[model samples]
Target: MERIASVDEIPTKGVLFDYKEGPFDEQGILVRTRDGFKAFKNECRHLPMRLDDREPADIWDPHGRYLVCNSHGARYRPDDGLCVSGPCEGSHLKELPVVVKGDEVYLETDKIGGFFNV
Candidate 1:
């Protein structure tokens, strides 16, 4: 496991983090939701691109209830990473395993295998 951020570091807009998946450098998104903390790869299911690729730091829609893919207008649920609208509808974001310990958030690197195994 690798420490990513503190619980307080995650804001309503969420936080972006960097991690290593095998030999590749990847990014992750950590959001604090009503159910607790959720983390996912900073990627859009419709394409091999970051959701905020077109708009830096602008990953949320006007209402802030869903995570929007700036490049394609895909909206995803922060709690489950499900794309509910736009081109990627019916698709889900790649979820990353995270654990909260005390006041810090940790990325379960061991659980980050599968497609990221490389």
Candidate 2:
């Protein structure tokens, strides 16, 4: 696992990750919830485009109840990364494992991202 960012750095809404390993690049989103934190690849189920196509902070729905895709108005629940409405309904966002230690957050690059597998 590699420390990606501080827990404090993540906003209450969410944040985008430009995760890269050698030539492998994947966009991700991290959302902090009352239970803890949830992370998922930024790709939407209906398309190859990112959910945060406009901006990371803009992913939230109008009422801030879910993560809204700017392209097709898809809404994903922050707690479970599930699409509740839109073209991708019934599909799930690809979840990534995360660990929170003290004030820092680390991505399980090996189990999920293959960051330093050599």
Could you tell me which residue pairs clash in candidate 1?
Answer: none
RMSD of 2: 3.3
lDDT: which candidate is best? 1
lDDT of 1 by residue, 87-116 (tens): 989999999998999999888888875223
Residue 30, candidate 1: Cα error in Å is: 0.2
Model 2 reaches what TM-score against the true structure?
A: 0.86
Worst 10 residues of 1 by lDDT: 109-118
Error of 1 at 95 (Å): 0.3
Q: Rate the local accuracy (lDDT) of all candidates.
A: 0.85, 0.80
Look at candidate 1 and tell me the lDDT of residue 40: 89
Q: Which regions in candidate 1 have their CA more than 4 angstroms from the true location?
A: 113-118
